[model samples]
Structures are given as structure tokens and as C-alpha cells.
Target: MSLIQLYDTTLRDGTQAEDISFLVADKIRVAEKLDELGIHYIEGGWPGSNPKDISFFREIKKVRLTQAKVAAFGSTRRAKTTPDKDNNIRTLIQAEPDTVTIFGKTWDFHVREALRISLEENLELINDSLAYLKNHVGEVVYDAEHFFDGYKANPDYALQTLKAAEAAGVDCIVLCDTNGGTLPHEIPAIMEKVRATVATPLGIHAHNDSECAVANSLMAVACGAVHVQGTINGFGERCGNANLCSIIPALKLKFGHECISDEQLKTLRILSRTIYEMANLIPNKHQPYVGNSAFAHKGGVHVSAIQRHPETYEHIRPELVGNVTRVLVSDLSGRSNILAKAEQFNINLDSKDPLTQEILENIKDLENRGFQFEGAEASFELLMRRALGTLRHYFSVIGFRVIDSKRHEEEKPSSEATVQVKVGGRIEHTAAEGNGPVNALDHALRKALESFYPQLRDVRLFDYKVRVLPAGKGTASMTRVLIESGDKTSRWGTVGVSDNIIDASYQALVDALLYKLVKDQEQAG
Candidate 1:
């Protein structure tokens, strides 16, 4: 098996997604995580693009990465300007990453229309930029933007671009499918042509406009491209870039490539989920390999088959990617699904246990009432604990009042909440103000419990998501709120459902605090 290099552009290209944005601190943290995964190269960002990226490059230097080399991204020197005089090239050098990757116009249309420069002038830009950077940087990677399209339009000119970079002593030449329209079957021929034209090692950078970025990258590697460029969770402009979460496993398991060790591969799910958490984006549950639903079995037949032989329903072991096989309890779930979940939770229950049938009936009834346990495992666990008579009562809510008003035209709306709760034998009353009713409620609830459970101060709600349930009646719907909370050491999720949105949010918030308290007590004991 040939060793293929994994290059991550999450901090740079991945941020181009409409919903994705990363601070300098986030970039540094993500870089450390990617390094921990033993990725070959980490493209920090374009130093010339913004202050945040510039700060990222400076801050990332302080991080002692164990394996990955940080790469600084930029474009070629401007038309008619010397490489030494170009500000973009100068900024890349100032960023001082381990490698410098500069993209140049490869398509004849871009050279003539976008750059508005002659074909020979564009060639000079590629050659001069790479040669100038080669002297200062240990490695210079030339990204031929729109290479496949360029090859299709003018194959001879595109091949000349790769030859120009190679002659300029570039360390690697990356063929970019900037438009992401190239079919997988078309990649082999282009790779063959590029290999014949240039002696330098080839790389691939693919976008996902056609939903084939992963396929294109794999195809490129199969055809002799050694370096694979992509972003975590497929985050990027347009549809997205090639998803590294999918590609890494594909390379390791399917292709027999050694990108990362088996141990590091197990951290793949955590890495994928962590990125989504940091970005404040809900992870796509159905995403391949690392998604929540990747190994989930819902059908009765599938669950029964998987219980007897996992390979019958699963393509690969879920543990290989740090994900677990889930047997969801829904209207479609079977007794085997409940048994599997019970075993996972370590509950002493047999498939033939009377309580098992009761739990299954309860799950079906609750699901019919718009409760989804698949995404709300905390709630599901609490339900099982209650049924098993093992639930820990941390606190009880007596009452709560929330008020929202705008007293003056010039003033912003204000929200205030008062919460009364009982912990042990004492009743605590608290009042607090917040930007919104939910925030006020959250503050007041925590304040009420703070005196009895001071550790509640360490618990913070990071994410709150609300979904309105389907209504069986006309013009009325219930709401479900999922709250993700964390302390210094760990994080967990809890869920709530009610006709009132505030009530639903409050239920989730209370469960979040209670869950943390119970967990802390258990750990302490």
C-alpha cells in the first residue's frame, strides 16, 4: 500500500461555508486536534486575507504540533509584479508556516478572462511565485486552480502550467477542481496526462458541487495522486469541499492506505463532532462514517439481523471510527433493538423480561406523542432509569415566573425570571434578568440551585435547539428543546417537550443542571 498524504484545509477553505466560521483560538484548537490525528499537513489559512487568519498563523506557531506541518495558503504573485514585490507573497512568507501553498490560474479562460493577462504572463506568475517562495520556504505547493476543467478546455496549456511549477522547483503540484464539475471517471485520464507532463508529486483539491468530491479525491489517489486535500465535515463554499471525515476512513479501511494509525482513527468521530460543536453547527446525523445515524439500525429486520451478526447489516465496525452501533426505539423498532440498548446501558434486563415489553410499549407511546429518543439519549436514559426505579432526584421545581416587556420606545426589550426550587428540605427563591425569556429562566434556575449545589456554577449551557412537533389538531403544535451543557471536564445533552416553547426550554435546562449534579455526585462517590 502506498502512503498517501492527508492535507486539511478546514481553517482556510472550509470556513468559506455560509454557516461555518472560526476564531483564531478555534483555529489553533482545531490545528492541535488535527495534528493529534496524525494528519500530514494543516493549511492554517491565507495570511493576506484577514487579521484573524494572520493572528492564527502567529498563534499556531506557539502550538507544538507532533506530526502535521502547517501550510500557509495564498494566490500567485499579481500580474506584472515581481514575486519579491507582491504583498500577498510577502504576507505568506511572514506567516512563517512549514509549507507555502499558492494557487495559480490553470484554466485558459481564467488566465484570459479573470486575470486578463496573456498565457505567457500567467506562466511567468506561476514560475516566479513558486521559485521565489522555494528559496524562503522548505516546501512550496503549487495549486493549479480548475486544473481538470483547464485540461478539458486546453490540455496542452494546462500540462504546461504543471511543467512550469515543476521546473520552478515546486515541492508538490496540486490539481484543484475549483468548479467541482469533473466526474470521477474523468479523473484518471487527467491524472495520467499530468503525471506524464510533470515529474513532481501530484496532489488533489476537490470541491463538492457535484457531490463527488470524495469520489474524485479517491479516484485521483488511485490514479497516482499522492496528497489528498479536504476539509472536516465537508464544510466549504458551494455544496462543500471533500469531507475528510469520510475520506480518512475510506483510505484506511477500503484502500489499505496508512494515513493514520488504528488508534488515531478511533478519534475520528470525536474530532468530527468537536468541530461541529466549535462551529455551533448541528452535526448532520446522516453523514457517512462519523454521523450519529451512520451505524444506527431502525428496522425490526435489520435490528434482528444485526443482533445475531453485525456484518449482516453494517459495512464496517462502528468502533473503527469512534462511533457506536445504535438500535433506535421507534415505531419501527423491535424487541432486539430494546435488548441491544439495554445491554449498552448496562441495565439488568432480558429480552423476555416483563419490564422490556413495558419499556417498548412506553417508547412507542412516547414516540407517537412526538418524542424522538434517537437524538435525545439523555432523556431516553432518564426514562429507563425511571422505569427501573433507579432515577436520582437531585431537585424539584416548585414554580417559576417569567416576564418580558419594553417600557420605553428607546429601550431594548428586557426579560426577568423568578424561580423557586426545593433542594433537600430547603426552598430557595431566585430572580434574574437576561436578554431573553429563556436566558432569564436559565439564569434564575441556576441561581436558585447555586446555594445548595455550588457546583452548578461550573455547569454552562452551550447550545439550545428547539423543534416544533407535528400537530394532530388544527393550528396547535408542541415544541421539543434539546440543551447541550458542559462543565470543565465533560459535556452531555438533555431534552424536554411541552406545548409552550419557554416551558420546553425550561424543562431541558432543568434536566441539564440535574444531570450534571447527579453525574458529579456519582463521580465524587
Candidate 2:
């Protein structure tokens, strides 16, 4: 296998995604992370397009990167302008990137319609822009925007466009599926023709519009392209760019390519999730290789088989990509699932023990009543410990009441909750007000217990999600609540279900606090 250069466009194309924006510091930090991951190139956005990108290029110079060359992205010089006079070209040089990548129109349609220039003029534009930048920049990469579509329309013109960039001395010629409509079957022939046409090193930059970006990139590589351009977690405009998260692992493990070290490949999942968090987007749990469910097992038979031998159900060892094999419990769970979970929780339980079957039945019954423990593992652990008679009763709630009142139509409703709890023999009652009934109950419960268990002060509710079962029932349907709680050290999830939303919230809130106390005891031991 040949060496493949990984060019990441997350800092540039990824920011074009809706609801995704990064600060200058965020870009620099991401570039550092990419460098650590052994990425070859990091495209630091188009400096000539926006002030924020210009600031990123200015600020990133202060940070030292051991690997990965920072590249500035922009378009080729305009049809009627000289490279020296074009503001875009001038700003790209000023960015002082280790490399420069500029896109030029390859499609006959775009050359005539978008640029309103003759085909020969567009060729001159491509040649002149790259030839001038090659003198100023250490390396220049040319992106043939709409190359595949242009090849399908007018093949000769497209190949000539590439030859123009090659004649201008570009380091690499990147064929872009800008529309992302090309399928995998169409890539090899075009790539082979391009390889025969130009001696320049070739690259592939694909988007995910047809859900074929990863496939197309791999196919292009199989056909002799040496460089791949994509974004982390596939974040980009519209359907997003090719996912480097999927491509890197596929190249390393399946193709046996030497792009990244095995140690660097182990950080793939962390990198994917970190980028999602920085972009303020939730991680795609179903995404291949790096998702939460990438190696999770939910079926009884599948879990049993994996327990005996992981190869039965898993393709690659989850640890290879910094993930773990997870067994989910539900109505489908069997003895193997219970045993697997017990082992995961560090609890001692025999497979033949009646308590194991009992716990499994209890979980099935609870799930039947609309309680889900998939995202609420803390609650499931507590349930298992309780069944084993190993759990401590930190506090007993005697009663709790929540009241909501609105005296005027224009005024917001007010919620207040009072709680009475017993810590051993002493009883404490406290009342608190909050923005909602659930928040009020949480506040009152914490107030009533913080004096006895000061550790409760360290725990806070991080997230709350409510889902109504049997959707058409609306207000009358059962409500399931999932609460995420965290302290300075760790975070865990708890769940509850009831007809009343407030009661469901209370159950989850109680579990959240009790789980925290249980964690404290476990750490102490």
C-alpha cells in the first residue's frame, strides 16, 4: 500500500455547517489536537473570506505543533485579475501558512455560468494563480471544484484544467466532488484517467451528499490517489464533508496503510467527540467507528456469543479505537446480559443465582412500564445493588409536595416544593422555590439533606430529558424522565417513570442523589 496524506478541513469547511462556529482559540486548539493525532495537513479556513479566519491564521502562529502543516484555503485568482492584484491571493500569502490550497472551476458549466469567462480564460486563471502562489508559498494544492461533474459533462476540458495546475507547479491536484453526487462505481475510471493524464501527485476531496463520501474517497485511493481531504465527524455544509473519523481507521485497520501510528489511531473516538462538543453539536451515537453504539450489544443471544468470544459479534476490538464493548439491558436481556453487566459494575454475582434471574425479570418488567436504563446505567446499578442487599439507605424521604400557582394571565407561574426526609433518626423539612416544579423539588430535597450529607452539595443536575410513552395519549401518557448528574470527578445517569411528570422527575432526582452518595462510599472504600 502507498502512503496516504490526511488533509483535514474541519477548521474550514466544518465551520460552514449550520450551528457550527469556532473561536480563534478553538481553531488553534483543534489544530494542535490534529497535529497530535498525526494528521498531515490542517486547513485553517479561508483567511480572505472572513475576519475570524484571518484572526485564526494570525493567532495560530503562537502555538507550536510537532506535526501537521497548517494550510490556508481560498479560491484561485479572479478571471480578469492578476494574482498580485487579487485581494484573496494577497491575504492568503499574508496568512503565512506552511501550505496554501486554492480551488478553481473545472466544470465547463461553472466556467461559463459562474465565472462568466471563456474556457481558455479559466485555464489561464488556474495556471496564473497557482504559478504565482508557488513562488511565494512553500507548497500549493489545487482543488478542482466539481471535477467529477465536469468530467462527466466534458472530459477533455476537465483533464486540461488539471494539466494547467500541474504546469503551474502545484504540489498536489485535489479532485473535489463538490456536489457530492458521484457514486463509488464512477470514481475508479475517472481516477485512472486522471492518473494517466497528469504526473502530479493526486488527492481526493469528497462531500457526503449521496452518503458515499467515505466510499468514494477509498475508491479514489484504491485507484492511485495518495491524499484524502475530509472533516472530523463529517461536519460541513449541507450533508457535510467526508468523515475523516471513518476514513482514518479504515485506512489503518482494513487497508493496512501507514498513515497514522496505532497509538495515534487509539485517540480517534476522543477526537471525534471533542470536535462535536466544540462545535456545540451532539455526537452521532450511530456513527461508525467512533460512536457510542459502534460496538454495543443489546440482544441476549448476541451478548451470550460475545461473552464466549467477542469475534462472534464484533468486527474489530472496541479498544482498538478507544471504545468498549457495552451490553445493554432491556426486555431482550438474558442471564448472559445480567452477568456481563454485573462484571462491568464490579459486583460479584453467580450466573445460576436466583437473584440474577430476579434482577433480569425486574428490568424487563420496568422496561415494560416505559422505563429505559440504556442511558441511565446509574439507576440500573443501584437496582442491582439493592437486590443483592448491598446498598445503603443514605436518606429516606417521608414526603414531598410541589405546588404551582398563577394569579394573573400576564405573570409566569410560580413553583414551590417542600420536602421532609429522615437521615437515621433525625427528620428534616425544607421548602424551596424554583423556575419549575421539577427544579423546585430538586432544590427542596437538596436543602433538606445538605446539612446531614454535605457531599450532596457537590452534586448538581446536568441534564434532564422527558419522553412521553404511547405518544397519542398526550397528557394521560406515562412520562419517563432521565436525569444526568455530575460532580467534580464523575458523571452518571438515572431514570424514573410515572404517570405524573413531577413524580417521575422526583424519582430520577432521588436516584441521582443516591447514586452520588453510593459513588462517594465506593471511592472511600
Clashes of each: 0, 0
Output the lDDT of residue 283, model 1: 89
lDDT tens digits, residues 1-525, model 2?
778999999999999888999998899889999998999999999999999999998898998999899999999998778999999999999999999999999999999999999999999999999999999999999999999999999999999999999999999999999999999999988998999999999999999999999999999988888999999999999999999999999998999888999999999999988888888777898899899889988899999999989999988998888888999988988899999999999999998899999999999999999999888999999999999999998999999999999999999999999999999999999999999999999999999999998999999787899998995887899999999899998888899999999999999999999999899998999
Candidate 2 overall lDDT versus native? 0.94
Worst 10 residues of 1 by lDDT: 468-477
Q: What is the C-alpha lDDT of each candidate?
A: 0.90, 0.94
lDDT by residue for model 1 over 385-435, one digit each (tens)? 789898888789999999999999999999999999988898998999998
CA RMSD, predictions in order? 3.0, 1.1
Off by over 4 Å in 2: none
lDDT winner: 2
